[model samples]
Each structure stands twice: as structure tokens, then as C-alpha cells.
Target: MTRPHDAAILELKNLLGPKGWSMERDVLETHNREARGKFEGHADIILFPASTDEVAKAVAICAAHAIAIVPQGGNTGRCGGAVAGQDQVLLNLKRMNRITEIDARDFTATVEAGAILKTIQDAAEEHDLLFPLSLGAEGSCQIGGNLATNAGGLNVIRYGNARDLVLGLEVVLPDGSIWNGLSKLRKDNSGYDLRDLFIGAEGTLGIITKATLKLFPHPKHIATAWVAVPSPEAALDLLALARRTTGDAIAAFELMCGFAHDMSVTHLPNLTRPLASQTDWHVLIELTSSRPTDDLQSLLTDLLGDAMEGELARDATLAQSDAQRKNLWAIREGIPEAQGFEGGSIKHDVSVPVSKVPDLLTRGMAAARDLIPGIRPCPFGHVGDGNIHFNFTQPLDMDKADYLAHWENLNRVIHDIVAGLGGSISAEHGIGQLKRDELAHYASAEKLKLLRAVKAAIDPDNRLNPGKVV
Candidate 1:
């Protein structure tokens, strides 16, 4: 039987040509599945546009028929934001990969949405500049997806989120009109700040086509160290002391629970403990200086010494060489990937105030243990910025599906604690289909009204990323 949207699909295919559009089962299946494999949905068709003009034209066709469009970048998103539901069209931006310009003097790079994050970082390095948004999926995640989600990564402590790093964006609005707001100027102070609207909107407001990103002076000296802290409280204290002593030169401050560290060593090969003695919590610190004359190594060493003397850190290990530095970071980055091997992990990307981290972790762990005996809690992430990946691994010898059945129940138990502490349910990850209902439960009526107003004003037809965010 022919579907109702088949006619429109045929028209779209012809408009985009064979190379740009496809209804093949493999293509549909590939685009439908999300990164975490937790959510999946089907699409009516997939459209790949190579330029801003092509994207605008394709969007016009979809808008004419009132067909829902799901804009996708590298599909590296943890949330189901990139997945399209039945009768919706999946708009892929990989073909639009282009680094149009790199202004070394201005310290900015203008690139298409499909450009890979690592590629952009490498380009900046060639010009002796740094694109400081470093994430685990940098090699494959596209810049557009990063901006769409307002990604916060390791360097957020130093450079802020993706929204802070982007100077301008060129977006295709819901009605097929192009909004060319791409400017490299440091300060605009213009109208409603449309660039910020589309960013972190997850394509609900519009499609991000290209961006002008901010760059920093390349760090000539870098020092990485792993320290064992007695508790999360001590870790926070050490963070403060490090900032005060180093003059805010710390690039990344990560906190990992002992359980998370153990998981990494157990599942990931070639990963070893950084410190001699294992403590309840571990912190990985990195300091970078753009000036070649600065001795970041000695500075980090002095900070660690003071932390140990003050009892903020139980033990510490400074990377003596580049190889050691990479090894230390690998352990930090590998924790999420290594978690899969532990089975049925219920994950929560949450954030609380910097001071309340200890209370959150201590109380949260206690609650989970009480709820499910033998459940392994693996809470870890950017403690400096107050975000923590509060993940839980199922009890050993239990069925994976059976343990996953309690996902919703566990979410309630943990998210309630987060709410009580005035924290957010979703932190770095935006509200996609996965957290859509949760957002409704947590957001206030006024907040929901504002979101609805924005969605209505920009996409009254509800043809863009339907059933997401608002």
C-alpha cells in the first residue's frame, strides 16, 4: 500500500536529484538509529543538501507540503534529537562540509555545518590558534551538531560552551527563508540575538547551515596531572586552590568516582591507575599557557604539592612526557565508552551547584544503593562546571533487559534528588525526544509558555522537528 506522503517524497527526490535524496532501506535504518541505541524511529525520506541554497530550496519544498523536517548533523547526539519519526523527512547536512575561511588575524574560522569538529581544531592549530571545544566524539561529531546542542566539553572550564565560542551562524528558518547572521565581529548588540536562538534549539527553531567560531591563542605549554582526592568536597577545594594559584590557567577539571575509574581499568585495555593509592574520588587536571616562556609544568607541580600539604589531595601523579599526558586524558575520555562493557547502565547527565556536588553524589549514591542493592554507581564528569554524568551499572549476574526495565523508576528517584538540590535533569544534553516529556514535568508553566511562544512564532506549522523540545 502507498503511504500518504509518497507523492511528496517523489517530488522531493526529483527536486534534490538522485545523489541528494534517498528512500533506500539501508539509508533509512542508518539515519533512524541514535548513537546510544536507546531510541529509534523511521523517516519518510532522507535529503542531503550540499549548500545553503540547496538547503533553503529543499526546506521550501518540505514547507510547501507541511512535511516535518528533522535536521541532522553527524548524528553523534546522545539524545534522540537527530532521529525522525514516521512521515517526517530526515535532512542530512554531511554533504555541506566546507571550511570556507580561517581568519588568523581575527582568530576566527568560518565553516559549513557539516565540517567535523576535529578538522576545524586541526585547521586552527595550523594557524597557531586553538579551537578549544574538546570532546570524546570530536573526530566524528560535526560542528553544526555541536552548535545545535550547545555542546559543553572538557575545555568548558576555560572556553565556555559551544554557544560562547560561536560568533555567528547562518540558519535556514522553518518557513524556508535563510537568515544570514554569520558575522565574526566580537560585539554586535543588535536585535533579538537570533544566533543564540537557533543554537541549542536542536533544530526546533531552524537549521544551522554555517558558523563563524571563536579561536584562542594556541597553548605553547601544557601540563596534565591526575590526583586522588579524599572526597568530592576536597576535589572542589583543590579546584579553587588550583584556580587561585594558577591564575585561572586550568583548562580541564574532571572528577571521577572510584567505581568509574575501576570500570575504565577493568574494561579498557592499556589503561592503568595514575596514582599509587586508590581514593574514593579522582581528579584529572590540565593547565595550558599560550606564552612559551610560562612553565606550566612547574606551576602544576607546585599546586599539587600545596593540595597534598593541605590534605585536599591524598596522592598525585604529574605527566612527565607527552605520552603520559595522552594516557591520563585517555582514561578520562574512555570512561563513557568503557561503561558499556559493564551492562545495563542507566545514565543521567545532570548538573548541580559546584558546592552541592558532594551532597549530590553522597546522597544520590546512598539512594541508588537503597533502591537496588548491589547496583554500581559510576558518577563522573566536569566537576568544575557542576555537571556530572550520574550513571548506574546494573547488578552483576542480572539480565540486562530486566535491569533496564527500572530505568524510569530510577530516573524519578535520582531526578527528584536533583530537583531538591536545585539542579537540572538535563545538563549538557538538550531536551530531545528522550527528555521531551521529562521537560514538561520539570519546567514551570511560564517557561513552557515562553517555549511554546517561540516555537509558534518561528514554526507555527509545526513542520520542523515535531514532538521535540516544546
Candidate 2:
């Protein structure tokens, strides 16, 4: 029995050759599921295009047949942006992984969409440069997905998000037209910035095939510290103090609740607690200087001393050795993973103004507590940039499935608070299937109209990544 879209799938398979497309169960399972097991995706055929030409041809075939295309990278996204649906073609780009050019003089790297983030960072390091976009999934996540999500990571405090790091992108549009905008130049006063339109579009308008990314001088002098703060308010004060103290050397400023720290240690039993003095809140701060002569450690020590004296911080542990620095970072980075050990955890990636972060924390926690009593509020993240991974662990007595049932209700209350504070509901994470309706509800009518206009203008048939961010 031949299906209506079978010819399109056959065309893609023929175009990609035998090695390009897969119908195997295991391969489909991996490509179809979300990273956190929240959503299970579906696709009739999953493809692995080898080059830009192959991708363009495949997309053209799909467009001609009116077949839906779900462009996927490493599938490490939390928002399920790359997750495909029934009858859609999953265009996985892992085979296209290539760092085509690394121009040290230009401080730019042109890489294929499938290149692993950590691989690019190491490649940059080899040239005595730095590609600073980093997160928990750096080892597995692809650069294309990072750009699609406009990813913000540990370095965003000093460097900026993935959007800020990218100079240009090469995209295969819905109609299968290749737009090579891979410019390495920092400045371009063009009519309209088309690169940005595709960067965070989640593959709705186009499939990002490659990118030219900005790199910086690798920091030679580095300092890391775990400081205890009384509360979110004190954390903000410490953030201000560190920013002024470090100048442009500030790399990361993370805030965590006491329970978040405890969960990290518990998740990895071998992990060492960075600080002895446990308080309600903690801050993991890092400062880096490219200059070899900069006394970053001494400066950090002095800054911590001042912060402690001013009562902005309670206690601090400075990482004296590289091993100690790694230990501190390990504890800080393990927070996202540690949530899984606990029962069902409701997650929110929201951001408010740095000043209003305190209010967000207080009000959000209180509201969640009222909704679900004894639900452990494990809030933590890059407080320097005001993005908090405000998550709630299910109660001891509650069933995991039952607790997850309140996901929608919980999101509404917390998101309402975020709106009141003039904060973004989906900050670093894009509005994937998880928050598509939420985007519609919270977004202004004018903004929604414009977004739809753009989507319609690019993908007239809604065949490119349908059921995604509009």
C-alpha cells in the first residue's frame, strides 16, 4: 500500500543515497524523542544529509510534494523544537558535521550545522582563541540548534548569547533556495538583518546549514569562587559588586538555592561541596582575563573579602588550583542534571530584569508553594543575566504523573508573575511545542501578527517545521 507522501520520502532517499536516510526503529526513536523525555516525536523518514547541496535538493523535493520538513541538529534541545510529527521528514544534520574554516586572524569559524559545540570550542582553543557559547549539552548539542534557539549559556554574562556570537548564517529556505549570508565581517549596514530572522526561527522559515561564529582571545588568567549569599537580594548585590570589581573580566555569575546545591552533591555522590557555610542562597562566580599578567586570583580574593565585609556575601571558597576550579564548576554545572534524580520536576526558563529577579524568585516560589504544597522549589541559574531555571520538584507523597499533570496550571501562575515584572516567559529557550500556546496567550496581538506575517511570507504552505513557533 503506497501512502500519499511515500513518493516524497522515496525522492529524498534517492537524492540522499543509501547512507542518508534511515527507517530503522532505533534510529527513529533517537531522532523522535525529546532530550528530557517530555515529548516523543514522530517521523516517517529521518535523513542525514551530507552537504548543503544534498539538503537543498531534499528540501526542494519536500516542498514540491508539500511534505512537512523537520530540520533537526543534535536533538539536545530542552524545548523539543526539533521534534518531528507523523508523516514529517526528520532532516537530521549530524552527518554534515564539519568545521570548514578556522581563521585565527579574523577570529571566526565557519562550521556546518551539525558540528558539536564542544568540538568547536576545542578547535578555537587550539588556535589560542575561544568560542564561548557553552551549556550542559555542549558535548552533544549542535551549533545549528544553538543558533536556532538563540542559546544563552555560562558565558552569556560576559560574551552574550548564541545570536550575539554569530556573524552570519547559510540557510536553505522553505522553497529550497540557498541564501549564503556567511559573512565574517562584524559590521554590515544592510537593508534588513536576515541572518537574525533565521537564527532564532527554530527552522520554521529555513533550515540553517552553516554559520560564521565570532571568537575571542582565550583567557589566560582565571579565577572561580563559590560564595554564600543570604538571599536573592544579596546575590544581586554581590553580582553588582563583582561586575564593578572585575570590569570586563566577569565570565559567569550563577545563583542557586541551598537545595539546588544539596541535590547536585546527592546526584553525584563523589562530588565535593565547594563551600562549608550553607545558606539559603549561593553564588558561583568566575572571572577570566586574557592578559597573562593580570592578577585575577588576587583581585577575586580582594573582591570577595570586600563583599564579605559589606555583608553582601556570607562565606566564600576560592578555587586555588585548576583541579579545585574544575570541582567548583562541576558542582555548579551539575544542577540541571541533578533534577532528574528527584521525581517529576516542572521546569521554567524565565528571565526578568536583574533588579526584579529577587521579586520574581520570591513571588514565583510562593505561588508554586500555594499551588502544590511541599513541592521543592529548586531555583538556580545565570543570575548575572537574570535567567533563572526555576524548577519545582514533585512532593514526597505525590505521584510523578500526577505532579506533571499540574504543569500547565503551574506555568500559567508563574508566567503571569513574569509578565507582571515585564519579564520574558521563554528567555534562552525558544517557544517550541512545549510553549507554543503560551506564546500565543502571552504575546501581544501586534507582535503575534508580525510573527505570523513573517512565517507566512517565508513558508506559505506551512510545510517547513509545521506546528512549531509561528
Worst 10 residues of 2 by lDDT: 1-10
TM-score on alpha carbons, each prediction: 0.98, 0.98
Local error of candidate 1 at residue 171 (angstroms): 0.6
Model 1 over residues 370-435: C-alpha lDDT tens digits?
988889999999999999999999999789899999899899889889988999988888889888
The digit string of per-residue lDDT tens for model 2 on 87-188 reads 788899999899999999999999999999999999999999999998988999999999999999898999999999999899999888899999998889
CA RMSD, predictions in order: 1.5, 1.4
Q: Each candidate: how many clashes?
A: 0, 0
Cα distance off (Å), candidate 2, residue 269: 3.3
